[model samples]
Target: MIAGEFYKWTDKKGTVHFTDNYLSIPHEYRHQIKIQKMEETSEKKMEGIAAELLIKKSVNEERKAISDGEKAFNEKCTKCHSLSGKNQDDSATQLVGLLYSDKFKESTLPVSEDSVKRIIKEGGGEDMPSFPEMTDKELNELMRYLIPYLKKK
Candidate 1:
């Protein structure tokens, strides 16, 4: 019997791919297109779903990394640095007070903001510990916080 209202074909290799116009092919070739198109459609759908899942996972990972950085700064830098409008009761604040003294003002050392950041990164005297782990941005922020108190009269 004819395959259907629309005939199709196959090859000796057993591939069943189809075209709507298959009338010129031999009878033996008709079986090749007989199986179904739904299987291929399902495979493509699965591939699309996998790609979407991977994209979502990458975005989530980036957000998580930023969250972890913020948390770490709060736990570490916060122990010493105070936010704006806050009291200066912390050890780091007290240290900054000394830097603002007339003696510091009189010192020949450079008074620029980058210089202040270097002091924080490398430590001034034996009383201060090295902050090798702090990023350049964090060091700059810490220096900015202290600069107000250390301004020249």
Candidate 2:
């Protein structure tokens, strides 16, 4: 129709009813029903839809980042590093309890995001080679994946 409208009414039991069709109102309450413009309702609906879409987008992006981070770790660091404290090689370092490790706890440097990022980008002695080629996005995603496993301070 040219203009949209809303019909609202309250029943004898104080239950409120709302509808867009005028004919849906009961015969007895038809004359007492209040008429409202659809503009406010449409705006509210649009806002709700927008918020829901935004939340879904954020969740999808987070899942993708986690997946990418796991892939990156498998490709780049899994050879010499072990997650879940299961070392394939005795020489490899266990990365599961990074903050809780004797090396990190004993060292003057705290186990922090900056320190971890630096170690990944730079080298942690001859055993660990620097990955200067790793992009910032890949590093960030990898860090996110590792954050949960890292022992909190």
Candidate 3:
């Protein structure tokens, strides 16, 4: 049957009937009938649902990445670099200023992201311990978490 067209008529008992065929509807009521369009195709509806699902999945993945990055940073870096600057010792530098320091901003010496990653992986001289066991995915997430603070504008 064709979509979007409707026929309306009153039966002999004066009850109203609605059908899709205009020819089956009594001749007198055809002039007063109005066409009603279908809302959307099943494919279009499914596409909309798919789009919503993709958006939800993307958001969930982003949240998971942020959470994992935070956890990795807390576990791996907090011992040497204090977030609040209250518990930092002389053996390790406070991280709050490391990103904005002249060395980091200029990407000089041991201050760039590549340098930081290498330090995280290989240990920074005698004071820092190596985290060679960290997976590539974990490192990427950790870097993403640090990028906003560490990257020069």
Candidate 4:
């Protein structure tokens, strides 16, 4: 049936009643009857619910991307780079701090998303090797994981 306005009230017997006619309600129940505009309330509630679900879905997707990124890092980058600065050594670079390190800051490349992605895709000089085989989606997931560790100037 098409949505329309209606009145609802609870009677003395505690039975809830609904009717489209306002005057049909008993005079005593009239004081407590609520006028509900079905179309407006339903549409608004649905919109609110849809927005909430979209936000939740986006959060979940980002979380999954971050998790995937961490996995990729462990599989491909842990040998030469460390996320916790505990693996600082002759061969390993502890990438635990901001991207503003002397190495990155001094380079010709700017500290932006595109630059960072390019650096990752095409090696960062003698020490860093290029990930020529890594897919763009994988690279994006890896970036999501590394974002928390990098602070921009």
Cα lDDT of model 3 by residue, 1-153, tens digit: 365544445666876555555665678777767554444436575455456547756887877887898899988787667556443334246555565665455664566677777877888758888889987788878887776655433
Candidate 4 lDDT score relative to the true structure? 0.75
The TM-score, computed over Cα atoms with residue i paired to residue i, of candidate 2 is 0.65
Predicted model with the maximum TM-score: 4
TM-score, each model? Answer: 0.35, 0.65, 0.55, 0.66
Q: Superposing all C-alpha atoms, what RMSD in Å does each candidate have to the true structure?
A: 19.4, 10.9, 15.7, 12.1
Model 1 TM-score? 0.35
Q: Tell me which residue pairs clash in candidate 1.
A: 9-29, 10-29, 10-32, 16-32
Which candidate would rank higher by TM-score, 2 or 3? Answer: 2
After the best TM-score superposition of candidate 1, give how far the Cα of residue 116 lies from its true spot, in angstroms: 1.3
Model 2: lDDT of residue 36: 64
Poorest 10 consecutive residues of model 1 by lDDT? Answer: 1-10
Compared with the true structure, all predictions reach lDDT values of 0.55, 0.75, 0.66, 0.75
Which residue segments of model 3 deviate by more than 4 Å? 1-41, 85-92, 97-100, 105-112, 151-153
TM-score, prediction 3 = 0.55
**Residue 152 lDDT (model 4):** 33
Instruction: Tell me how far the alpha carbon of residue 137 in candidate 1 is from the true structure, in angstroms, after superposition.
Output: 1.3
Rank all candidate structures by their TM-score, best first, as comma-separated numbers. 4, 2, 3, 1
Query: Which ten residues in a row are the worst by lDDT in model 2?
Result: 84-93
For model 2, how does the per-residue alpha-carbon lDDT over 24-88 read when each residue is reduced to its tens digit?
56899998877766675678764654565477568878989988999999998888776765542
In model 2, state the lDDT of residue 115: 92
